[model samples]
Target: MIMDIIKQGGRARTTGRPRDACPYPADSRERRAWFEGYDGSAWELSTRVPHPSVALRGVSACPDAATVSNQAAAAT
Candidate 1:
């Protein structure tokens, strides 16, 4: 997996390694940097080619009922 490290007040860095690479060893610079600006909510993962199963699931799921109800109310 390609890892992108973004630190506050610093340029983003990209690190390429095998998907199974160890995240960090104890007492490593990477570990320290990760801890300094780790914001779980700001992180996201995306792919250009999604799996077939995921696409199928998304298509099959129902749309938000509340949104449909709100639109109906507005129309009336």
Candidate 2:
């Protein structure tokens, strides 16, 4: 998966697609052709901190699914 985080109007928006379907591989001639055709800044590879939307809820950071299931069953 290749995620693209774009900065627009003071907020961050993300878009992505599977890497295998892309025509622009890093070392390929197709990548150079793609850049030449676009007017925007060149795409870059980067890592980002987790987005707030992905924050954990009602569970630990690394919860075990089986343990959570058992606990929920006990509560009912």
Candidate 3:
């Protein structure tokens, strides 16, 4: 399986390696960052992508969610 390089700490998932194979020392901020990245990437692997039609409904955010929603609300 091709490994996906994770974003936060620029780490990659090596084939046959456990998801918890973080190089950073445990109980450290770096480890926490890696763990957070693992959490997100793992979740991404499991969840289905948002429907393409969502963007047509203005669910595609620009800048940030709150700002876009506020702008949309104001426009209505």
The positional error of residue 51 in candidate 3, measured at the CA in angstroms, is 16
lDDT per residue as tens, model 3, 1-76? 0223244433433233466677778776666556545444333345533334455676744448878789999999
Assess the local accuracy of residue 50 in candidate 1 as a C-alpha lDDT between 0 and 100. Answer: 35
Expressed as tens digits, the lDDT of each residue in 1-76 for candidate 2 is 1123222211212234332433556776555434322312344524322334454343343458768898999999
TM-score of every model versus the real structure: 0.24, 0.22, 0.34
lDDT at 37, model 2? 26
Report the number of the highest-lDDT candidate. 3
TM-score of structure candidate 3 = 0.34
Candidate 1 lDDT by residue in tens digits, 1-76: 1134324312212243332343556676555444333322122243123334455676533358767988999999
Residue 27's lDDT within candidate 3 is 78
Ranking by TM-score: 3, 1, 2
Q: By descending lDDT, how would the candidates be arranged?
A: 3, 1, 2
**At residue 63, what lDDT does model 3 achieve?**
45
**Once superposed on the true structure, which residue ranges of model 1 sit more than 4 Å away at CA?**
1-4, 7-22, 39-76
Off by over 4 Å in 3: 1-16, 41-76
